[model samples]
Target: MANTKAKAPPIIDFAPFYGTDPTARQDLVAQVRAACLDKGFFQIINHSVPATLQDAMFTLAHEFFALPIEEKLKVDANLNDYHRGYETFRSQAFSGSLRPDFKESIDFGPDYQPDHRYVQAKHAACGPNLYPASVTNPAAFRTTVDTYLAAALGLANDVLRVLALGLGLQEGYFEGFATDPVATVKMLYYPSQEPVAGEGGDDGERGINAHTDFGFVTLLMQDDVGGLQVFDNDTDSWLDVTPIKHAYVVNLGDCTQRMTNDRYRSGLHQVINRSGRTRYSIACFHAGDPEYVVRCLPRGIGGEGGEEKYPPVSVNDYLTERTKDSYIRAEALNAT
Candidate 1:
């Protein structure tokens, strides 16, 4: 019988990127650039986030999901206008599919003071978080999540440096853009889906509908129970992105695709928990400053007077529009 194992995503280590050796860093940058160009997704290891911290995060997620429905609803995200707090199962869709995802999530961002500049400006993505006091050890949950968010943001900044080098720009080229990034960390819980419908199933019950992320980049940490799949444009088939010990799945998003003038495509991916056990994952979405104007870089536009394929757009507008479309679709489906 032919080998039936799914193809794994390319794996890259961050050690070289963090070291003082320029040659090693350059080589790593080249590898990353190639991977982005070809697949727009890769697994990163030696990323500096402690394994203990990762474990703690998974534990908190499991505990959160185990809370009573009433308790969980106390921090329902629907109560907030900025998309923070807990989202119940089957609350939203990924994109085209009107079917609700079979997962619950809690979204949080940088803890901005009420008078902070971003908050003062009324940036929807920058604000306080909603933590349920009903959960046992709410303090522990808060600390773990905050620490994880810090770590994720650090790693994201480092990756952006690598991408800058790969694109032949100054290492700090993206720093200004990220100064006040509209970042968000989401904790996702996917319940067991035993006896799942047969292969090629789309009965509006997927764990997460197929779609591309709308941010600049996303760093995802997943547990051992794997069901993540990436759509390969070349093969027109789904490739399983198996979980690797101590590795984070990194992928470009729609904004990055546009900034790169389609040189690096945003990966289309989804999750389906076929495992009998529940699945937990954390995703940190790092975007440019809300007011930053994004346009195709000269190199991204190709050589010899290549035309710009995308127009300049502020990060805030782009994200707002995307969010509107996503919620509109979900609301339409729910109303039916």
Candidate 2:
């Protein structure tokens, strides 16, 4: 059972890091390290991304999702080899439950052409993005999204630098992994649902089921409708992550845990939207360069035997295996 007095995720102000004060920078790094090792989650405020841009991205999401069902289907993600387009509502089941997640999404990545190195080599989840040309202003939609993606990538870069420092490495330690990154920006829509009785009397159908992410890190921007919850290992309960205006909810992924040999956690979280209003969120899943090998960092291999918890694996191989498992699980549930 979830605790009635649930703890909220720690909120950190990130703007101070931009100043030239070394103490401020170190303090920010310490906060991030603590969050990663504890809850594996934190909320960031006063970041570089503009508020206007975020609002514009949400507006574009509304515009795209408002299209007719047939119009949206023209870019069905399943039709393409890269799954870079639209994914239908309730088509994904993240927790191995019979009930699929009640959400629809459209994914966009770096618009690589056929001649790009990754695309030419047929890398997993690497391809050009698909935009809905049928929208009222298709050009505006694409342009705004592209701009927003750039902003998200910028924020990710800064966060990665902070993470590197927290891990006791040079700020540029993660740069090698970023060369030709396979990151993605996903726009998700979850419709309102009837409440169900469970862990907290508020637990309901899964908007997104309980699962850990499959990459280096995840950065999410969500609207006012509350549903996101993070599992608290200490209290053995689910805690609500209330939205902070224009703030990003950042979390580590499985790959990060693998790199740290489990010293840092990859927390499990789920969404349950019973607010009687639709929920919209944008998540940037930042995977590293496909070919980079993820090995345990020196600082993390410190058990009695100094052994690594997980063997080294390439980014592509890890993501491919995880992605395959997700699809298979979703398909199995849908078939039931």
Candidate 3:
């Protein structure tokens, strides 16, 4: 949350993700994997989603927020057991010490299956999305948002494949856990830029309070205005991370960290809106299937003989705790 002018990454043309570019793509994959192992984050280019789609999404977001406060309140997130709808300023809480991120967000993801055994119980944090049926352009709105989600999900698949390969496993080593994963996409709009309005000298006091991602990985499309910062494990500095044109900002989540036994770090990421420019970002969260147990891998362990490293747990248990911190409940982690 400190006001610091950080250098933006040198802009690079994205040749890696485009078709028929094998060498470049492989190199791209290698770089991302390396970054994931070291810092657990990277900016990617050439994973294309049409400019038209991005534009429409922004347009609809504007209209959605412009609706009368009364109507917006009707869909406020607190009303539902599943927290997948309109969130007014200060609704969602962050880790202790930061002011509520000065923003409002619309969160949604793939619908849950009707036969999903635990739909009524496990997914109190998963529910129907809030959409204004009275929008001016529903067609353009749905198409663009859906396209953005699909694109991010596809990119996630590619990254997971590379990760499996990068880890010396068959390509689909991670695929078995991905069935009907609890994918989430959130649209964030930080308040209009203003002088830092809150007390400083403490953490979590910015437009975006700092926290590590909770799912497997997160793919984000941010506007040109820079505010994203990532903790640098090597430098011990919270370096500024700006969006590169045609690039997606990617980072590992806490679950990935636990599963990997810290092989990958789920570094802290935060956004500052100092430019006074309203920022728009579409972030997609990738998760494992609800039933997938996210225990440690054989290779991730290092026992007394330096053989293995971690205790076993399921992805479902990990993710549920991540989203609601109530999966095992506070008493469970605290039990004697």
**For each candidate, what is the lDDT?**
0.83, 0.86, 0.67
TM of each candidate vs. truth: 0.93, 0.94, 0.83
Better of 1 and 2 by TM-score: 2
- Model 2: lDDT to the true structure: 0.86
TM-score of candidate 2 relative to the true fold = 0.94
lDDT score for residue 59 of model 3 = 73
Better of 1 and 3 by lDDT: 1
* lDDT for each residue of candidate 2 in 1-336, tens digit (9 for 90 to 100): 754554577999898779888998899999998898887899999999999999988888888888898998998998778779999976767655657788999999989888998888777789888989998888988998888888898888889899888877789988898766998999999898887667656433688988999998899998999789999988788899998879999999999989888877888899888899999999999998988899988753323136778999988889888877777778887787
Q: Per-residue CA lDDT of candidate 1, range 1-336, in tens?
A: 554444457898889977899888888998888878877899999987899998888888888888899888888888867788998876777567857688899998888877888778877577788977887888888888889888888899888888777777788988998777899999999998756477866565668888888878899999999989998876678888989877999999888888888887688998888799888999999987988888888863322136778899888889888877777777777778
TM-score of 3: 0.83
Residue 32, candidate 2: alpha-carbon lDDT: 91
Tens-digit lDDT track of model 3 for 159-232: 77766665656778778876567788888877654565567534344666667887788888787777888876
Best by lDDT: 2
- Deviation from truth (RMSD, Å), model 2: 2.6
Error of 1 at 335 (Å): 2.8
Error of 2 at 26 (Å): 1.2
Q: Rank the candidates by lDDT, best first.
A: 2, 1, 3
TM-score, ranked from best to worst: 2, 1, 3
Clashes of 1: 0
